[model samples]
Target: MHESPITGNGDVVKARQAVRVLAQEARLSLVDQTKLVTAASELARNTLSYGGGGTMRASIVTRGTSTGVKVVFSDQGPGIPDLDLALTDGWSSGRGMGLGLSGARRLADEFTLDSAPGKGTTVSVLKWAR
Candidate 1:
């Protein structure tokens, strides 16, 4: 499967379009498409809000025994000083309920976060076909 990279405003319509393209090409079910796209939205928002602008790298890959759609978000923001606290629901820095990453984690089948105080942040989420 091929991959597409998106950046900038992380517009809702564009993000969903990217997801639809993958799901269509991969022959993923409608249910999976909805969840995956929702997860994408969360990732995109974080990029826009905290990172002051970030990049969204998406691809379909086969890893080991699992094949799925993966979206990676990276940003050069102030960096999350408190990952633990940041992930908490309703615990936001300023204009968030603090549920972005946490919600994304719950929706995705596989989630990983890499962040530091000043070095920036990277997040990856994969949703495998069921």
Candidate 2:
């Protein structure tokens, strides 16, 4: 796994680039690469703006004959109090339209989220090669 710090908007861009590289290395199609990159951008921005910055871990994952990329974003900031509400479309705790999490989930083949009021949050998403 490779970890990159997400301290600001610039770091979010870096995260997107990093994911793009990994997706390319995994032999993902251009469309799949774009999807993963876009999802990474959104999640990284959320990590910085909402979670007060965090770390993004990218890794290559293989399952049988399938290979994919997995990214996990973690932060120590104030966690989502109501995950259900937070996951709702158009719900925003800050200035965004609240589409980051839901949108990322929609782009990835698999998505998982873990958060607590004071314990912080971690979101993991995966995109498989076609």
Candidate 3:
């Protein structure tokens, strides 16, 4: 796994680029690569803006005969108190359109979210190669 710090805007860009590279290396199609990169970008931005900075881990994953790229974004900031509402479309806790989490989920093959009120948040996304 490769870990990139999401301390600022530059770090978010770095994280997205890293994910793109990993997706490419995984032999994902061009369209899949774009989707993963876009999802990574959204999550990275959320990590910086909402989570108050965090780390993004990118790696290749395999299950059964399938291979894919996985990215995990984790932060130690105020956790989402209403995950259900947060996942709803057109919801925004900040100035954004609030499409980050839900949009990322739509783009990935698998998505998982973990957060607690006083703890933090972790979002994992995986896109299988096709």
**Cα-based TM-score, every candidate:** 0.86, 0.97, 0.98
Give the Å error, residue 64, model 2: 0.9
lDDT of each: 0.77, 0.92, 0.93
The candidate that achieves the highest lDDT relative to the unseen native structure: 3
lDDT of 1 by residue, 11-123 (tens): 64576678667765655678887888888887777877787766677788776876678888888888898888878888777555677899988888899999998888898
lDDT of 1: 0.77
Q: What's the lDDT for candidate 2? A: 0.92
Number of the top-ranking candidate, with TM-score as the measure: 3
The residue ranges of model 3 lying beyond 4 angstroms of the native Cα positions read: none
lDDT rank, highest first?
Answer: 3, 2, 1
How many residue pairs in model 2 have overlapping backbones?
A: 0
Off by over 4 Å in 2: none
The digit string of per-residue lDDT tens for model 2 on 1-130 reads 7899999778987898899889999999999999999988888989988899999999999999999999999999899999988888998888677899999999999999999998999999999998
Model 2 Cα shift for residue 95 (angstroms): 2.1
lDDT string for model 3 (39-87, tens) is 9999999998899999999999999988999999999999999999989
